[model samples]
Target chain A: MPAVIPTDSVGLVHPQTVDFPEPLTLECGRSLPGYTLAYETYGTLNAARSNAILVCHALSGDHHAAGYHSVDDRKPGWWETMIGPGKPIDSNRFFIVCSNFIGSCRGSTGPASIDPATGEPWGLNFPMVTVRDWVRTQAALADRLGIAQWAAVVGGSLGGMQVLEWAMLYPERLRHAVVIAAAPRLTAQNIAFNEVCRQAIMTDPDFHEGRYYAHGTKPRRGLALARMIGHITYLSDDAMRAKFGRDTRNGKAFSFGFDVDFEVESYLRYQGSRFVEQFDANSYLYITKALDYFDPAAAYGGDLAAAFAPIRASVLVISFSTDWRFSPERSREIVQALYRAGREVAYAEIEAAHGHDSFLLPVPQYLAVMSAYLERIAQESGR
Target chain B: MPAVIPTDSVGLVHPQTVDFPEPLTLECGRSLPGYTLAYETYGTLNAARSNAILVCHALSGDHHAAGYHSVDDRKPGWWETMIGPGKPIDSNRFFIVCSNFIGSCRGSTGPASIDPATGEPWGLNFPMVTVRDWVRTQAALADRLGIAQWAAVVGGSLGGMQVLEWAMLYPERLRHAVVIAAAPRLTAQNIAFNEVCRQAIMTDPDFHEGRYYAHGTKPRRGLALARMIGHITYLSDDAMRAKFGRDTRNGKAFSFGFDVDFEVESYLRYQGSRFVEQFDANSYLYITKALDYFDPAAAYGGDLAAAFAPIRASVLVISFSTDWRFSPERSREIVQALYRAGREVAYAEIEAAHGHDSFLLPVPQYLAVMSAYLERIAQESGR
Candidate 1:
């Protein structure tokens, strides 16, 4: 048997932990205990604690928002392109706090976390979580850090869902809210994508109904497959075409068979395969479901206006025109809802071909928008 | 062990084989004797042979074009919507010949087919095939059926690739060509999508370098994931939103964990799960490669006009306006090529929100345009 060469390189890059005890009541009526959040902090909190910014991570995001890790040579994290020392979310100016969400596998209390009672990983036993639950956990973390208020609460996509939740659940905690490429509710299309991914993870024979760890057979293939599908949605067709055309592999004519005929095939394969090294399939199911169940408007009698009624924070909603997953129309829905609530809101649907990932990419226009918004927020807060 | 549930009752329908062999030589300098083809004939062949129309199937399509078996309630076939007694192809007037392509799993000489020497499934040892191979095989079948000429060859998407190939490879045999939602060459974007799907299939742990049959694991999850990805491309974002738009199954509330949340997710899951039962993963890889490698213009030099130089058939090129996979621009390229070839060509880029699958839907404009084109072909053939 070939020795299983562990790509231990993954997850070793950053080590973070946040310990909380006992059961945390989730909005869905489920109770989760031993709630420990793994996170990373960059820059420094100021004396007034007003410069603290809560940066929410997306579906597959993590705590290493910027800067190099001592354990690994790889760059800071997945959003390294947009969240560095002098980047838009400038680590130099603000104390950026990013925590791995409750259901994430990155050292968070997720499906792979050990269950105290059973001495086994939680697997499907972990209580179902909502966007509100994730936001509440962040609040607990914030209170522990002596940050009574935030300069801004910002996120994109699923992270954007969290940002919206923060505004509704803890309006007094944030002076400004930046929701990028996110929606107040998961459109049926969003849910559909999530459902397919969950099904992909669960249907794998190795999934073993979420108990595959004991058998030493991880549902890596399923996780990878789900990631590949998600990757497609994250990119625009134009970008895919421009990046990897129909060029055949190996400087040889196409074998006319299924031999990884194009460069794109190899790239996706690498992405999917590498993802499974650190991600848990069951966590994929949990997080995707959390994203699907997020609907701030539902709590306010289907009136998004009512949901934002309590918010006093200045809102900055940024959407990418080409983001099909969470389109500009969805952002517009948020803008209209804020308007109805009489809340101070600013919205911009930027034109970009990068699709949903525009927020993470260093597109000059997106950076410019965020930089301006941050500058205005700082000025308004007297920072 | 859980028993493998066959998909959608289609597997219960017994298929008939059509033996077609010739001295086959490939562009890769490989030769094989006795290539067997499997096909199904619908409608009766008229005495004059002018009523014969060849129907080319898509990537995973088989010979069963229309009508369910009485014993099994499976939907007739994927293309059942467009081919029936009085439908667009008009079985009553035109004898329809639908063949399982050369590298397809449906009773064709593909990875799942038997090798006469070993008396076992060829598996990965199956020869790599091209669009030209499938076209040549169809041509051989026509010859055996005494179809000296076809009134028209019709197909959509990958099927359209075959239609174009028929017109190019043996123009004398075709009187009319109908290509729908297809391109002359596989753009980088098309290759990228297909490549990801191939990666998903190949990376399945059970895939075992394409020898999973012995392990009783068929890379079903991977193939299903691939289909899930492909299904997204087949529909426009607007269509997905309109059709599913966050509609949930079981209940209206979000599960707040990993599960199907929206109507679209459920639909995509259904598509992916249902696909794996009838389709082979290896076949998916081979067929997609063929599509990715299909560049008719490149075959006849960079000029598409030259590719159509030898094509004498009158062409009816159809495109769906919302089809991002094969956009209207691609159809225009074909029209321009045919016009430059001095061939009688009619073009229509239909306004439909259903994306590439619009051709198979009941779009009145699409139906009307195709109906008119068929009428013209029928008239020209002295029907």
Candidate 2:
């Protein structure tokens, strides 16, 4: 049995690792002698090799973007709905590559990766990787993969930051850039939330000052608390109210005790526990720092337009109405910057109650806009 | 020297304790054998005893609601901005009382209070207290003060919740109820946040299952984290942005390491540290639990109008523009329910960017509304 692949899915796929053996300098002025990136690609390239689209994953995301890895796999990748045969990215029309970002823990060389020098997990010894560092590593990966110029580079949230960086760092490498649910830089409140999450992880006793890998333990409790807080920010107040409201876990009676009383509490706790099982606390620290440090306008005297001037890619920005984390206003700021820089930019503000997580969901309006814009890109690239 | 008591101030004030030795039944079906409520009063009750107004304090608040307790006090009480002789609360006109809630640590019978049976702090053994229980305690305090009825009941946040409870528990006891920045019940998101805070404290090694008092230590890290999270929620996003927008503690260069990159992180950490010094971890647990449990419509078959139908007090509901913690929409819900119950109600949604803390600020519009409402009440009561 070849494992009945669903008609809409890209089907069973495998991840590939590409090694960079040369020393790579990071934005923090540190250097990694070598590293590896785990990636998965779908679809095929045309003779001109211009049909490729690079997909960037957000914080806590991985290379798996559209298909299952095995027949018994319970769930597909994170953005399956928007990256199938006839979906928005349309695997049938364009070759796609999704790679796990460097500072992330998903099969990528991150803080949890073993350092050859010490024969131990890098942990805090890992150089502080910025969005620019991730982009630079990704640019090298693209070179190794022979992707001279991508038909489009697309991502959401932190992934979206990478797309913006691609536009600035390698102006001619991406013909089209799709930035979804991202900000040019984090707001004070966003930084505060990230700081809290970092505090939660760093404070856990098992954390051992980020040396828990040798302690044969993990900062599970602190990581769980961080994830729980993150989950609250991911959903809108209306979404949470509709999903759980005052609904108790056991029955109508209040627990009185500090056990799980509301369904939302149970949901958050479960999310936290599950996250701790799969996530590296050190990676969470590094990745959130990257998110907090990324500012497109920081180097250009705080002028967004001046920062955006180097971009040659035609930009498309998308935002959700209720996403307080990366609000529509943020997307508009990106669009405004693009306009000021004389860049061709398209924008759509999708009305959705899912909040920051709306970027991951298959919102009809959101998908429609993505499909419509990418369709034009597909034609323009002769895919 | 008497510390130059300003003429417009209430000058000096002190908290008084009233004992209730009889068993006090809690809404959770538990009973406290004996307890004492700590309270403060300003001004004098008129001959008719109808000039008194009950002022409820919110979570983390105390009975020291106004003026200075000692000559060299660095700051007056929490509500000093609006509680002086000529302020909106107007101690010159109304006899004001603010009592610490029973589940709180501030000079009240709370989790930190000595358990008479074991001669240890109640800790986790403290009987779960509800808003209704708080109202009952306030009613007893009223009796002890020789006041039969209050001209008005006023509070903000959890205190606002107490005002609502007073209207329901003792309809004739309060002629007017002023609810500020409060929801009728905690939303699922609200509960989720509280649950995370509780989880942080409980998981800390020093927590010792809420018996930290006996262990001779406190969950300082967990409690600090909880307060940091709370502080973020207290301010509106716009307020935070205006106050601390990526302003680094050590100039423009990012710290890269986790010490304190942004000014917001530093401020939150300072707040968390200060809160741990003045607050009890066990009380934080119990009080947040009470916040999670309160629901006026729970007993009335989820009917807000039915829950409010027995109320005889004229209700005044006020909310701030950016109070996502307890938004303006929630206040409107209260107003709508009061109208359905045929209760006299007035509503105001002040345009302020302080978020949930707007209720505590001396916003011009908010103060004007309060002064106008209380002025009418004062004239009607002939005080």
Candidate topping TM-score: 2
Per-residue lDDT over B36-78 for candidate 2, one digit per residue giving the tens place of the 0 to 100 score = 8999999888888888999998888999988898888888888
Per-residue lDDT tens digits for candidate 1, residues B166-198, read 998898999899999889887765776676677
Please, what is the whole-model Cα lDDT of each candidate in the order they appear? 0.78, 0.91
Backbone clashes under 3 angstroms, per model? 7, 0
Residue by residue across A1-383, what tens digits does model 1's lDDT show? 01331222122234578799967888878788668898888766777777888889898888776655654454446666666555676666777888888878888888888888899988998888878898999999998889999999988888888888898888898989999999887766566666666766787778898999877888776787778767877877767667775666665666555656677777777888899997888888878777777777775668999988989888999999778778899899999999999999998888888888788887888889888887776666555
- For lDDT, the strongest prediction is 2
Model 2 collision count:
0
- What is the total number of backbone clashes in candidate 1? 7
Model 1, C-alpha of A283: deviation from truth (Å):
2.3
- Residue pair clashes in candidate 2: none
Give me the candidate number with maximum DockQ: 2
Candidate 2 structure lDDT? 0.91
Interface RMSD of 2: 0.7
